[model samples]
Target: MSLKPGNIVEGKVVNITKFGAFVEVEGKIGLLHISEISNSYVKDVSEYLKENDIVKVKIVSIGEDGKISLSIKQANLEEQKKSCKPEEVDWNSKKRKTNSIDFEDTLSKFLKESEEKFKDLKNYKNLKNGTYAKKKNR
Candidate 1:
């Protein structure tokens, strides 16, 4: 079978190099780059996978030189998809506003916080400049 870009397939690790692993899938050999091997950190390919290991991989890209780039990460991501349903995202939900909420109170709260931060900064600067002195008890 002719392998195409973006097709998920099963492959065996025929060879492993420092840069990547050679996977033979359905009589078609592809390069599984180190970057595409796993979702999490993989310090060494041998530690994560070994020769003759069977793994499901996704065809991420195809170069003009007929180099098939496979991704184990993509395959793992596909597996994760099977466990969850696609969430119905309501884009219009962002536009919804409650009438009971007062905007002025939020604004005043933000302004009050800003004033307090500014006062603290001013006090720090004055202290650094030796303009602040301890008051003497009368």
Candidate 2:
């Protein structure tokens, strides 16, 4: 079977390295990079895959020199979609929750805190320039 970009196919892990694993798909070898092994961080490629292990992979790219790049994570699109559930909020509830502060209030609070910090900085600068007096030690 001909393999192209976005093609999902079954492959065997022929060889593994620190960087990635080589997969044999339909008599053709493809490189499954460590990053493409999973959506999460992969500290060890061997931990997730091993030699001769069968896995489904997606063809991410094909170089002119016949270097095929594959992705195990990208092949499982259904699994990724199933795991991600949209958060639903009840907008019609009569008892409106006021506990969560709105954006405008948060912005105003941040600006007030920023102004206080600027004032403190200005005072410190004045003290450093000898324009502001330091209290004498009794």
TM-score of 1: 0.61
* Deviation from native of the Cα of residue 105 in model 1, angstroms: 15
Candidate 1 lDDT tens digits, 57-85: 99888889877889999988987888889
Listed in order, each prediction's TM-score against the native is 0.61, 0.58
Tens digit of lDDT per residue, candidate 2, span 1-138? Answer: 689998889999999999999999999999999999988999999999989999999999999999999999999984567689999988897785679888899999999999999999999998876743444432
lDDT of each: 0.86, 0.91
Residue 138 of candidate 1: its Cα lDDT? 22
Please give the TM-score that candidate 2 achieves against the real structure: 0.58
Model 1 bad stretches (over 4 Å): 86-138
Worst 10 residues of 1 by lDDT: 129-138
Best by lDDT: 2
Q: Clashing pairs in model 2?
A: none
